[model samples]
Target: MQIATMTIDEIRVGIREQKFTAQEVVKALFQRIKKVEPEIGGYITLCEEDALQQAIIVDEKIKAGEKLGKLAGVPVAVKDNICTDGIRTTCASKMLEDFIPPYDATVVKKLKAEDAIIIGKTNMDEFAMGSSNENSAFKIVKNPWDTKRVPGGSSGGSAAVVAAGMAPLSLGSDTGGSIRQPAAFCGVVGLKPTYGLVSRFGLIAFASSLDQIGPLTRTVKDCALSLEVLQGNDPMDGTSVKEVKTKSYLDGLEEGVKGYKIGIPKGFLQKGLNEEIAKAIEDSIEKFKELGAIVEEIDLPITDAELSAYYIISSAEASSNLARFDGVRYGYRTEDFQKLDELMEKTRTEAFGGEVKRRIMLGTYALSSGYYDAYYNKAQKLREKIRQQYQEIFKTYDLIITPTTPSLPFLCGEKVNDPMEMYLGDIYTININLAKLPALSMPCGFSKEGLPIGIQLIGGEYTEDKILKAAFALEEELKLSTIIPEGKEEI
Candidate 1:
């Protein structure tokens, strides 16, 4: 079997049964990465030496007939924003260019506990700031499907690595549509779990309240598998859900959406949504209906306000959270500065990318004394209404469905100059984040140009199992094959 293309189940079973040594699998994946990485630019840092060493231990464990973890020998890529001890956790920005973390993020610790090899740290939009992956200070990550087009940000590298078959699984942080949008653009499965479902202990904070760490995988089952390992409360993270009533997401995953009440927002298919994406959602509704689900259009009490609110709230949190990056502590510092204030100013000015600076400014402005109530406070109020609206919908329906993105992946430079237009790409997704709900995005169909279109399933807080079930059922129904891209020497 192609080692890089194997699913999580296949790799675990294959490793357990010794179809191939874990060391061999790791080596083969490196071979694949070496071949494609120049073209795809998915990874910012690869742990081939460390990964090979870890793989040998898994192989030795299997030889001794020792019990293995769920992710034994599986090579999982990590987004750069998540800390990995001793590895430089650069958020694709110069600020943290050579800053090595002294401790692993909680999720990274979990991955190691399960024997999942840390294949590499994937590139992403700097500080997880932009909607398109082009905002990285290191290099722009191109979509694996079409190199000329963008992979969605800021988890674009996570999605691209999986799509290119460089890694079977990758973790992405979703603040707004970071995880799901990139997954949709790359035709992979990406999830944004209910807020606090996964520990955010080591994630480089972007928008703390809205940020969530989730997995991007080739299949819905894989997403569920990743979540099982990634979830649970952490003392280090006050936000990690402490009393969540958990269930097996994989148990009834394939049982289909029969007898389920699925809600579609009435008039949600506005002119802003792409024609092809709209058609795909309509088709998905029919598929859900055919699968014995009760699909109906329901009126949702929200609007474009979410787009404004998301930016204001996320930026405000970013302003506060990012304050720790002052030049005195760590990260990139200006070589020349006259005073402490001048040092902070020069370090920040020289190190942060344009997009990062932009958000920081917006956030600082929103939280400033005069504008606090007008921008930040109003955004918080809108956030509460969004949460209330989702709670009301969940009281009556099992799931809420919509197009994951308003449009298909566009050309790289298409919207970069227009920040508002770039922000509009996340209109369908930011609301779910605003409400801190669980949502999954997976392939439903492909556009005529062969770009993948994704359908999103939004569920109430902590209702990931239901969302996964519906996504899995629809995935099995559609039967869309994975399109692993062949890379060129250069973009």
Candidate 2:
């Protein structure tokens, strides 16, 4: 049945119709992973034994003629940063290399409640620090489209595994473009819901205020389905928004964007846009117009300062959140240290990666007494400006459209040494995170080099449904559903 190529809906139906047992589906995908994972480096830890056992239980439920959960028998990949009980949840960092959580993240519990089996924990940048996957202490995730190229950062492994068809759906945390950037690079659907929409209780924090857990999937419908399971409040997360309408995200997904107002930020394409990507964005705009959407050019003049503000605010939060990972607690401890102070200093110094340390220092310095207002406070004020700008725009536009990334996936090691170059890769995506708005990145076109190009559809806070509907319309029009990597045939 080519289980690897099946969508979440297809798999759910197949299982219900007794076309394939959940166990058989997991087994088939495990076999596919075995063949492609070496090349893709998508997973940090595969939960083979655990996933198979869960699959057996799901099959038994189906055999008993019992009603299965909404996502029955689906195999999913979770980014390593999200906590999972009894499974190694390394944030691709040396400090937590051997860390296993005592409890599952809220989303993990929710997925399990819906009968989804977590196949594995995917690799990510160390503590979700870098724009490229090179920051991982374990391994680099290669773009399935071109192994020599990066799969994008932080959530790179989640995107890569889905692109390789190793898992039908995967979870990724977007602190600042982590999910969307990787999804764009890998040519899949990545949706970052409004910050407070999904509970983040058990996600290992990168930047608590900016970090959000979302899904990366092969299709927009699958993305919405995962969101249905992922959204809602948890008493565990104080920041969770309980006022959101808790309904199925896929209820009216097939409704095309007939009377929607979509705006393209003029500042996004003002400069530094690749010629090819610019053309792709224009083409996508015309397609949306043809689909009966009201497309227009709008001004988001604050785009220039979003990246800087994001770095300051996010790093400041990161420094605070990561402070808990000292040697006294359960991560990695220094083998040699005499005093408590020495031990803490040495543990963090040795356990953390270069990027982590760099951010920590940057954050600490920003928050230091002498520089607080100049850096962190100023950044916070600028953040408000960015948010208010989006708020004003969303009042006029139903969705904001732009290129997902400034360029195609760069070759591995191309910009790893040049931090600025790597950071600039997220130019188009960071602002949405700062504003805590929902946005989705989907495949729009391919670069001349055969690499994928993505177009992002941004929504107002809690407007994920509208964004999904628009993305679905464009996804249908593009007809790029069958665009798999060249090597999937063998798997």
Candidate 3:
């Protein structure tokens, strides 16, 4: 059987029925990685021995007639930024090239407890800074849809692995639009849960307030299943909310979108959006309407300021969070320097990529004595205003709809020179982070060039189930069959 082509649910059934052993699935994934990693560059490190060992244990448990967790035996790729005990967690930056955490991140712990096998650590942009994955200190992750185009930033590796059929499910951290943007580029589903909804205990800090850990999968149902395992609060993380009961995400996968109110934010589909992407989103809305959803046009007054505030706030927090990587305690260390100051300067300069350095400088400048109130303080106030705007809109709407990205995946090196233009690609997604709302992006259609386009569904805080239900409804109404990457055979 072609294990790589199967969904997470299908794999679980295969294991339960003894149609395929977990070891065989893990072996197939490794073989797939060996074949595709050269072109995709999805992983920074592959934990072959560890993953296979765990899979064997799962196979034994299944043979012993022991009941398993929801994700038992499912192989998942983890983003490099999330700490994995005993594995190097570099965040795709040279500064932490040799750093290995002594403990797993909270999400990693949860996945392990559920018997999910960690396949490997995936590549990402340095310190989660760039819009495209090209900023990684290691290598860029290419979009599975078109090898010449880029997979979106930070979570690019995680998204590409699932899209390319190298892994069934993966974990990705979304600060700004990392998870959703890459999912859009790779033609997969990515969920960025509400702030504090998932524990962040050992996720290497990017933009602390904006970052939330979620899943990247081929289907919305797989994302929901992964979230179920990773969603509870952690005592180790103060920002994590207390345990909240969540609905069975898989229970309503086939439920149609009857009596649901989907809001279309008019400002989201204005000028600058590509005609093809706009049409795709409009078609998706029509499909939702046909599925018994009530579509309404709404306005978010602070949409314009969202990107600006996101940059200001994120950069400032990143600068502060990154201060600990000075070579004295952890991460990459320089042996050539004599003095402490020289060592610190040399290590950072050589270790960090240009984008990471740029943000650090921008953030340091923003938080400086005279500029704090002008940039950081003002951005915080605007963030509150944006959150308030979302709160008001959610009162009348169940979910907000938008084109996940303004344009299809661009050719490699196309916008690498222009950081501002690259940042603008996330216009539709960054606001959800700013407002602390939950959002999901799913493949909706293809462009004229055969590249994939995505449609986003944004929901109120803690309304992830409602959001996924809407996505599932649209998925059926549109009948969007999964598309494999060109030139690849389904294993």
Candidate 4:
């Protein structure tokens, strides 16, 4: 039946009708993984036994006539950064490659409660540092659409799994476009809910203030379905907001886009963006207009400073969050160290990838005594300014639209040498984290070379519903279902 090709909605319907058991679905997924994973490198750890056990339990519950959650019996891929109890939580770094948590992360707990079978832990850029999956201590995750190109990162593995139909849904963490950028490159839907909207207790720290966990899925409705299970507050996480009662995210899928005002930031489309990307975004904006959305040009001057502030603030927080991985508590340990300092240095140097080390050094330098105020402190102030700018823009517009990335997916190893250039590629996305807003990335068009182009829909804080509705409308209008890479026969 090609169960992997089914969307979450189709799977849910199929499960209700007893067309297939959860165990069968999971077994099919593992078979697909065994067939494709070696070439794509999407997963780091595959829990075949545990996954089958959970699937069996879900199947039993259905047979017993027990109520099931929206995600019941569905298989979803999890980004390695999000902790799953008893599963090795390696944020694609050698440091925690063998560290297993004693408890589930907030999201994992919620998914389990919903009877979702977690299939495996996917690969990622080490500690969510780089935009390409090449930085992963594990193998690089290639784009399912074009193996020669990257899938984007550090959520590349999650995005690849969905694009390749290995999983209909997956979880990804975005500190600075970790979710959206990859979704864009892989031609899938990736959403980053507002800061504090989803609990972060189980998500390994990257940039504390900017990091968020959200879904990467085949469709906007699938993303919404996953969000229904993952959203809400956990007392364990101080940043989590109180649970909010809302209608089903899928209820509004057919709602037309009348009376909606979508703001297009002129600054985003201008300067530094590739010609094809700019045209693609404009074409998408026109599609929204055709769908009855009132498109207007808006200005967001603070976007120019987004990348700078993101790097400074994110690096500072990373330096702090990563300090615990010094070979003492968890993760890799050095056997030949004569002193504590030697042990710490050797372990860190050996365990961390180059990009992780670069960010740590940048973070340490930003937080150092004399430079703190100039770099870290100033960056904070700039963050507030960006937030204020977004707030003001949202007051007049229901959502702001822009290109998810300035260009299509670059070939693997294309931008690896120049760190700064690679960072610049995330220009349109990093600011949303700084502004603490909700945003989604969805496929808008395909480049001439066949690479996917994504358009981002940014909304005010806690405006996930609005963003999803807009994305859903666009998805219907575009009718852009992604195609699996042609080289999978060789995999």
- lDDT (C-alpha) at residue 34 in model 3: 87
lDDT of 1 by residue, 1-491 (tens): 58656788788888888888888888888888888888878889999899999999999888888889989999999999999998889999999999899999999999989999998999999999987889999898988889999988999999999988888899999999999999999999999999999999999999888999999998889989999999988999998998986667788788788899999998688878889889998998999999999988899844678899999999888988888888997898999889999999989999988888889999999999999999989999989988888899899999999889989999989998999889888888999889999999998998888898988999988989989988888888888735565443222
TM-score per model over all chains: 0.98, 0.99, 0.98, 0.97
Which residues of candidate 1, in runs, are more than 4 Å off?
A: 486-491
Which number leads on lDDT? Answer: 2
After superposition, which runs of candidate 2 have C-alpha atoms over 4 Å from their true positions? none
lDDT of 1: 0.89
- For model 3, give the RMSD to the true fold: 1.2
Worst 10 residues of 4 by lDDT: 482-491
Report the C-alpha displacement of residue 451, candidate 1, in angstroms: 0.4
Ranking by lDDT: 2, 1, 4, 3
Candidate 4 lDDT over residue span 1-491, tens digit each = 57556788888778878999988888888888888887789999989999999988988988999999878888888999999989998998889989998888999999888888899999999999989899999799999888899999989999999888788889999999999999999999999999988999989999889999999998888888888888887898898887666446777767867889988886776677889888888888888889899998887753546789999999999999999899988789988999999999999999998999999999999999999999999999999888888899888899999899988899999999999999998898999999889999999888888888999999998888888888888888888854555654232
- lDDT of residue 415 for candidate 4: 97
List per-prediction Cα lDDT, in the order shown: 0.89, 0.91, 0.88, 0.88
lDDT of 3 at 252: 71
| Cα lDDT of model 3 by residue, 224-319, tens digit | 788888887789989888867755777776777798888887777678899999989888998888889999988764255678889999999999
Worst 10 residues of 3 by lDDT: 474-483
Error of 4 at 205 (Å): 0.4
Please identify which of the two predictions, 3 or 4, would achieve the higher lDDT against the true structure: 4
